[model samples]
Target: MDTRNITYFIAVFEHLHFTRAAELLGISQPTLSQQIRLLEAEVGMPLFDRIGKKVVATEAGRLLHQYGMKMLQAEMDAKNAIKELRSENRGTIRLAVLPSDLDFQLVPLFVDFKTRYPETSLQAFSTIFVREEVLAHKVDLGIGLSGSLDKRLVQVPLGSEPYELFVHSASELAKRQAITLEELTQHALVMYPKGYLGRDLVDNVCREQGFELNTVMEVGSASSLLQLVEAGIGATIQPKELLKQHPEWSHIVSIPIADPAPIRHLELTYYADRFISKAQQQLSESLIEFFKSRGVGEDLELRG
Candidate 1:
């Protein structure tokens, strides 16, 4: 019943002598005898046979020894697991990110983070989640286009994503290096599905420039939109960084918008109340340093 008594009993069982067991356990011989007696009374079984100057373990004592070994092992294992968890050597970090983040912003950082902490597990879910969901602790953190967020949510601006109209090289619209929103609307616009965050950003910019979207097809994902654009189905507007790595897309003309130079804020958002784990904290530091080295943090603004 009592672990202290069981420990003493195990020591005595192994040594087969109270005096020697007490010496091994750093306890008095009389105290070891009293603890063994208490263990026997609690289990309602005499665990030892005394024959004059010698003591031998009974059936009950042997059984308890087997179970007591298991209990002690389990406790030791639990302690080791907790230590590893606190040290960020083992644990799961839940992350929710926008689909676009996989291309330029999050992919490199994720690769670096994994390399730095190979033991910490990452559970990633790509979604069109807003800051409110992050604030609610629905996910540990999120990476997406930044905007005005709830006061409860804290956003760390990673950088700015520049907007450009992507069109086929041979298309009449691609003749110019950069074109206006007015010029882009003249052609059929293939874009994200309505209510999507990226589409919302494009729509907001269009509205600010005082025009309505003339869309040809609505796509569910960025990859699908790029594919359609590549096939010359229709031209679409998207972040410039998304096309940076692909030289094939270079043939596709990208005309930066004039005047306001439409740009979206990219950020790493998490709940203010949430206590960031060691892994998350390390990740946040790595991200900030990466962004700063690239000159992204020079103009970062924290959104509430």
Candidate 2:
């Protein structure tokens, strides 16, 4: 029953001599014999056969040795796993990020992360609803477009850029290098649903500039919105970074919106209610550093 006694039994069983086993265990021979007797009594079986100075393990002793060894190994394994986690030498980080982050932000950092922490790994889910995912504890950290967040959440700004409008390459609007708020409003516009990232920024900017924010269609998914824009269904306003990432959108051409730009910020957000794991914190540092190295995000601060 007692693990210490089991250890003593193992030592005695292996040595087959009480004096030698006690010497190996750093205990007296009398103490070892008394503990072995107590262990046998608790198990209701004789663990050893004593014939004068000769000692050998009984059936019960051999069985206990097998099971006891297993228990000890399991405990060692648990301790080792916890130690690795505490040391940040190993663990998986559950993270969520917008689809746009995969291209310019997360991908490059992931390469460096893997190289630095080879024993660790990541579970990533990409979507437009990064905040919701983090709030629900579905992911440990999230990187997405910034907006008002719950008080329980903390956000670290990574980078930001002014909003831009993308149109079909064949559209007459694409002939110009840039567009104005008034000109973009003259045509039908594709937009994200209410509460979606960049939705408020575009709408507010349109109102501030005295242009009506006309929405010809509304969608929840970023991919679908981009597809509609590429097909020339309607023009759409999105962060400049998204446009930079997907140059393969051959059907799409973007025009910059001039001065006093309506901007969207990208950020790393986590729940302030929970402890930030080493892997998650490491990732945030890597992201901030990644952006800084590229001469972007200079004004951004690494959030505590």
Q: What is the alpha-carbon lDDT of model 1 when measured against the actual structure?
A: 0.76
Candidate 1, residues 1-304: lDDT per residue as tens digits? 7567777888888889989999999999998888888788888999999899899999999999878865654554466557766674656677787776564456777787898889988877778864655654556677767767667678889887678888888788777767777766678889988798878887887798898788999988877887888889999888876776456665677767775656777788886644566777777777778767765556666777
List the candidates' TM-scores in order. 0.66, 0.62
Q: Using TM-score as the measure, which candidate wins? A: 1
- Tens-digit lDDT track of model 2 for 1-304: 7678888988898888999999999999999999999998999999899999799889998898767765654554466557766685667678897765664446767877999878778888878889888775667788887767567788878777778888898988888877787777689899987676568777777788776677899986667888999888999988776766667788898899886568877788887756555666788788778767755576785454
Clash pairs, candidate 2, are: none
Q: In order, how many clashes per candidate?
A: 1, 0
**Looking at candidate 2, what is the lDDT of residue 23?**
94
RMSD versus native structure for model 2: 17.0
